[model samples]
Target: METPSSDASAPSPWADAERIVLGRDARGGAVAVALDRGGEHGRRPLSSTELPVWVSAREAEGAATGRGIRWVWSSTAAWYSALLGAGVRVSRAHDLRLCHAVLRDAVPSASALREATAWDGAPAEAGPSAGALFELDDLSGNGAAGSRRPGRDGVAETVAELLRQDAAVAQAAHPGRMRLLLAAESAGALAAAEMRAAGVPWDAEHHDRILRDALGDRRAGGAPARMTRLAAEVREALGDPALSIDSPPRLLRALQRAGIRVESTSKWELGEIEHPAIAPLLEYKRLARLLTANGWAWLDEWVRDGRFRPVYIPGGVVTGRWASSGGGALQLPRQLRGALRADPGWRIVAADVAQLEPRVLAAMARDERMAEAARGRDLYEGIVAAGAVRTRAEAKIAVLGAMYGATTGDSGRLVPRLRRVFPDAMALVDAAARTGEEGGVVTTWLGRTSPPPDDAWRAAQARASRSGASPADETRALRIGRDRGRFTRNYVVQGTAAEWALAWLADVRLRLTRLAPVDSGEGAPRSGPAFARRAHLAFFLHDEVIVHAPAEHADAAAEALREAAEAAGRLLFGAFPIDFPLDLRISDSAAKD
Candidate 1:
């Protein structure tokens, strides 16, 4: 690998570059190329030991001189972690791995990158062995085919991919929107890494206390005390003292023997059945879930140094929403939120968007009536006020049914009224559903396309359309088609909502970095060296975000959160007269109450 130049008086190549691409040289060593508006200005290889210092210096210089630098790298997850570990943070980045996935699926026919399907593999995680950066399995069978292209792992390959992506975006049907989507998606990758590094403030004592209070005392090798008691109550009510409630099949048999006729033991079905054993059985199941999901074992494994550090996977879901690998981060139970306690002299600003999906639909469709209904208050209540439904409950059910393709029960029955009131909003989802039912793909507002129907679905449709197809075959095909329709119908709204959430997170992260750090004595040491003294994002759910900030900056953090929500709306919809109101709270704990 080429070494850093020895001339001390040489002008820095990165001094005026607007973008920099970082990758490994042929020798598996770090290399960076600076790019101005015209093209590449210079390229240099750096020792692994020198990489962090060089990046930090460039980042600091960029910040001081107002010369924003957007880092372009093969994978944010693989590269950003090392920089963050060394206390270096960048304002912007372009993750080629993530953008490749987006464009490959979104603009498959037009994207030159789609032809180079070696990039179609899963995202690279941190801590891989040296020289294994681009050694990913060929997942090109999904559509794109990998070429026998040499030098796929080098800096030159990365630069070439970046150029292809730029051309793809420029030639896309909605270039501006696609560009914004890629930027937001890349930002989410950075935020996910940063959030993992700076974990949520967890009060282990508080979490344990809550668990004990709810499930009774812990036991050595069995369920908690309250769970055991509830299990016993269920058996007593069923007149089967030795019954095993943990086994679904055995419990189903036991319930049937006790005259509780239910097909499944799910809580919803059990709640509908009025029996002496039902209440205790339900209680036992709830307690059992608590013990299994977030009990002592979970606490021991997930929490450390008063923080819960969960691994967040950006774009993990098909809808472009984030997913958690461990610690059930996305599935955090409301009961344990009290454990999300901030450090001393600090506060947590918790905010979540109100009816995010429905609001996104309204904005995407530009439905003026729906937007009016959503102005400054609860949307369901607004729908009720507009006479679309008799109650807020019906309005909510109808809106969800309209978006989710519900054709049965109360939700289905009330959807027609919503269609009449919000025709444009309903029409958008209806069209998406129709396209899905016909086995066609649908695109979100920002150009993230829904995955096409699989071969199984197409084969089923073909069987149903045969000359002598059976009625059963037809029925089965219709069911499968409608199921996919529901998925696609929701995909447009949910995917766009994910985009809005990313925009919100990216903006909030930038604004938080602008705030000055608190005194050293008041810093949250457990938040790691980079974020210990500053207001930084601590937790993010689909629509909710929690910021750990010093008490003195609580108001400012809350304001930034609200402003980011507004900015996200404008960024996605551009003055469409739609609002993304937030249910915000500033408190010492993240508990809803």
Candidate 2:
């Protein structure tokens, strides 16, 4: 339902599906047919219907030059869109012939798909749905409610408390700690307040119940459960009532000393290996060293006004994203969230997006079966219902590969079944794969296109295609061309998915802006609170986001998350047969290890 635009002036097929059945074949390129409604001036499907056509710039120019329209430039789907939009009456009688004609011609030479000495046609294993080709607005935070005034020395109080708290000191040693934490806290508070201000209908208890239901299967025997146990141990070791967790080094050290071997593997790729304690350990330590030596001093100087406000980078990732500053907020070390603490009067409300990418994939593919599989329960289990090969792990592997481009082992074996069950989604990604391997430019749903292929590669393709080359030699050159094509093919979907994320973030920010502040009056500053206390988006890594808030508005923030998901769905795909849902979790800390 999230339709990509062929041209800015043209409406999307889904948006105009009622008017026509858009379609194409290789020969005629893009084509459309008007729908026939019962009664009235009905135009029945006719092979000889005089269809008036409008062509793109190239096609128009070709007509003027007396050269037949090439048809190779447009895709079958794109052509089909043209047909539907053109108002031709189409039916089953003409489906296959019309479709084949458009597709056969548009299909590149066999060289585009076959592997050869010069190159390969096969698409690279997909990456987690990522690529960028869309516009995204920045996250907003313009100070606390009713006034643009900065909060009184509240940042100082929080920082001071952080300084006194030994565990906080260890974690805050990282650069941008104060700023990032403050931003997160501010965002959370603002979300809570916004619900009160707007008087939106929300059920905090129901939200909590949903989260619990979602998490029920999470604790089943798995790496996740082990990680939880490790976390509890770290909290106990820290001996801080505040439950502050330092970044990775401290956590890793604690786990290592306790003799817990933390292992990780990239399931999508074969031979992907990680030592039990090395990879994540090194990652955590590297950040700690950088932040400790460089970021803290800068934070101290920047927050002189009692406010350590940081910019919120909305949709920063190849996908829709948001990032933060001052605290290296976006680069939060896993297991380090407990380091975030509020002042005496305030409590933390932390929330994150769950199963976001998969859900989006389901809706975008228009896989009602998959959507229903995800309905009312865990999406992983939904895959099980969809008939993924054995175990939840296998199901997860297949679903992820389908999104990211894993084409080996279980992932490869599983992808076929997923495609069989979800052809629309499969076809969408397949088109992307085809486009990239062919070295064509890839674009997102909103028209953001990838940079064209490198000149050297293009030159090689030309050289290989020359009339002088032997058939064998020519095959090699075409293969190279196809590899480049695969890259672009994957690029389109990944990039557009990111765009969708950004749009969703922007919508959430706009809605949250209308909310009012929560007044606990418990720590209610008599002279006004410190910091530029706004509901701030503090962290983002790909699809996930972290928002900080005051305890009073935690429920409201949760509700806003649901609203944001719905609004985003409407914005991208419109109300459809399928519903796009977001998995959400709210806690007092930012821990997802």
Candidate 3:
């Protein structure tokens, strides 16, 4: 359904000129204005009832022809959620809030927009429901002055910010890279809103069954049967019948009294102590975590209409990785993957890049040796075969040490050996670490600048440098410096990996849009109208994505997932011979890790 001009690898030329701003009209009603060659056309007001219909018409029009319109909106969550609720989908958007955050830190020259009002605040999430209609009252005179959301402002303020953003990109040090980052970030916002609207195809029954098996039968106003049994076993082993297993401090004290001396009740620490209570206590803690994090209460709250919607905040992490404001979507346990079921007549295509961070680092450093070690399906195995290490396990340790700045155990000892083999890759991370240790900042491959040291950190360094500073102050300073160094060492790799994932997600979203919608009976109504039986990205983590598609188009969906991976690699590092192989699967359930 997309024309040749709709390639997602590069930024659009005409989209910059053909701006469609969605904001309030004069008297306080929502409107879509057209801007061309730097001038705005008259506003076309959209009523609450007519808003989704008009947007769907325009969006469908763009998808039909080769030419597409890039929607300039205040925030993706503020507007796109309502659009998706009505089953309308837009191709691309210029999320002013998301873009402003990027430019504020990355581009110092763009001070005008950075100093602008309401553009630097927290993103436009925490709004009303996606299913609720956005009326005139929400977009009227209560804009930046009252709500501090530029999207709520009248036509003039909104357009002014958009133009300022245009200027920001023009003055960027690497405008091309900045443009790609902004586009990828904005596309991520679109995908987040869409994913929340569509949600993961969830099976409430499967979730309950899993809960029953792991946690035992639910009890009214009490712990599960299996949990109670485990708690009893733990108490008996500790020789304290009145032991409060839920309280960590009390449990730790009980363990100490029973001769199992440990710092905490953590599984890792408890496992080292050869005490009978350790095993049952560990099992109890595991079950308790599950009950508290994703129990019956969670299922009742998150899962709705056969879907689990999660609120994603794009660029929430300083490293440009996505974070969840609610729903704990990124931390779902492996045991519950089976609960992420596809709807009837549909299949789930799941895929994740293998050794994503290492591959990204190889490309960024332009290290041919490292790239050769990462050319195959398993980067660790390839590293072993290249004689970097004797075994795959050792190779993994060295590579992880290089990226994460581990300098203490086997990682510390093996990293030097890796340094000799992959000098370029090691040098890149080493430079970042040194910069961070000196209170300097580092930028990712896509121009995402790392945050500098905080006031407390600088004060510690200052104390250490003073004439009368004691050994304590100097020791504290050295410790904190190493900590910051480790952070920056991984920040570059993780941030670029996030950018690559965003590109992959955006391309997959665009590709899925091109697939024809299936018949009416096969539609997943809970997923909204925009994503019917056709393939649609239902869930996304930092390095993985799960597409929900009709059974008939499963193969096509799988191909789209693979092609999007290749496109993302090229988009980030053109002609860089680095592979991002996926452990892909076509399954009825997400149980396969």
Evaluated with TM-score, which candidate comes out highest? 1
lDDT of 3 by residue, 1-593 (tens): 11222222223232333668887654556666777775764356666667777666666566656567888977787787777767778889988888988887887787777777566766555332222122233333334323434334455566767888888888887889999999999999999998987889999999999999999998989999999999999999989999999988898899888887689877888888787887888888899989899999999999998999988889989999988978899999989999999888898899999999999999999999889988865889888877888998899899999999999899988899888888999999999999999899888898888887998789999999999999999999999998899999999999999999999999999988878888756577778876865689999999999999988788888899999999999999999999889888888989974
Worst 10 residues of 2 by lDDT: 126-135
Name the better of 1 and 2 by lDDT: 1
How should the candidates be ordered by lDDT, best one leading? 1, 3, 2
Which candidate has the highest lDDT of all?
A: 1
TM for every model, in the order presented, reads 0.95, 0.48, 0.92
lDDT of each: 0.87, 0.42, 0.83
Alpha carbon deviation, residue 198, candidate 2 (Å): 21
User: Model 1, range 1-593, lDDT digits (tens) per residue?
Assistant: 22377442245867788888887665577778888879878788777677777888778777767988899988888888877877778889998888998898888765467788777776666731242454323312122334434432557667777888988898777999999999999999989889888899999999999999999988898888888888989999988988999999999999999998999999999999998899988988988888889999999999999999998889999899999889999999999999999999899999999999999999999999999999999999999998999998898889989988989999878999999999999999999999999999998889998999998899999999999999999998998999999999999999999999999999999999989988757589888888988999999999999999999899999999999999999999998988999998999999987
Model 1 alpha-carbon miss at residue 325, Å: 0.8
Q: Give a tens-digit lDDT track for model 2, residues 509-591.
A: 65544456554455422112321233434344455545544556556666776787677667666664444455565664444
